[model samples]
Target: MIDQVRALFAKNTFLPCDVSTIADDADLYDAGLSSFGSVQLMLAIEETFDIELPETLLTRRTFASLENIAEALSGLVSKAA
Candidate 1:
């Protein structure tokens, strides 16, 4: 999951540092994740996971870091399951 997120950032050329080194709790925004970058990440996540992120899930807190994004995806996957 983290790899997917990192790949997305890498593909967009928005990541500022080693994405693999980013902690799950790291603040992506603080780590140079711009609004546009976030949206791009969101799209990539949706496509990779094959799930639609509802509007309610689109928030700074949810996409704050790779861990948060994974948690959100896990929740959505579980609910679907």
Candidate 2:
């Protein structure tokens, strides 16, 4: 799951650094993730995880970092299961 998130970032131009180099708690926004990039990332996440993100989870906080995204995906997948 984490790898998929990293892959999305790597394939996109939202991040300034390599996905592998980003710290788990690094601020993705500070890493140069623009609003457009966030949306793209969000879409990629939804597609890759096969989960529909709730409106409440669409905030920047949900995509703030690798750890956050993993937690969000874990929660969503568990709920579906």
Candidate 3:
């Protein structure tokens, strides 16, 4: 799941640094994730995982880091199952 998230983040988010080099808990916003980029990433993630993230989960905190994104997707994916 993390791998998928990382791939989506790397492809969707226009980060200054390599997503692979960053730690799971690293701040993506600090790495150059703008609001527009966040929305793009969110849409890409939803399509890739076939899960629509609730509006409530669409926040800076939810997309803060790789771990956070994974955590959010984990819950949503489980519920989807």
Candidate 4:
């Protein structure tokens, strides 16, 4: 999942930092994730995971970092299952 997210970021050329440097718990916003980038990331995540993100999950806390995103996705997947 992390690899998929990283690939999306790379495909979009969003972040300037090394994708490998991004820890799962690190804050993507603080690490230079722009609003536009977040939108793109959201779209990529939705497409990659084949899940419609809930409105409630569309918050800074949820997408703050890779870990948060993974956690959010896991929750959604679990619920759907």
TM-score of every model? 0.81, 0.86, 0.90, 0.82
Question: Candidate 1: lDDT of 8?
Answer: 70
**Taking the tens digit of each residue's C-alpha lDDT, what string does model 1 give over 1-81?**
656666776667566776777787889889888898788888887887788999999998988888888778888877766
Give the residue spans of candidate 2 off by over 4 A: none
Q: Estimate the TM-score for candidate 4.
A: 0.82
Better of 1 and 2 by lDDT: 2
Give the worst 10-residue stretch by lDDT in candidate 4: 1-10
Off by over 4 Å in 1: 1-12
Residue pairs in collision within model 1: none
Tens-place lDDT per residue, model 2, 10-43, is 7777776788888889998998888988898888
RMSD of each: 2.0, 1.5, 1.2, 1.8
lDDT of 3 by residue, 14-43 (tens): 676789998999999998888988888888
Query: lDDT values of the candidates?
Result: 0.80, 0.84, 0.86, 0.79
> Candidate 4: global Cα-lDDT?
0.79
- Deviation of model 1 at 24, angstroms: 1.4
Number of residue pairs clashing in candidate 1, backbone atoms closer than 3 angstroms, sequence gap of 3 or more or interchain? 0
Ranking by lDDT: 3, 2, 1, 4
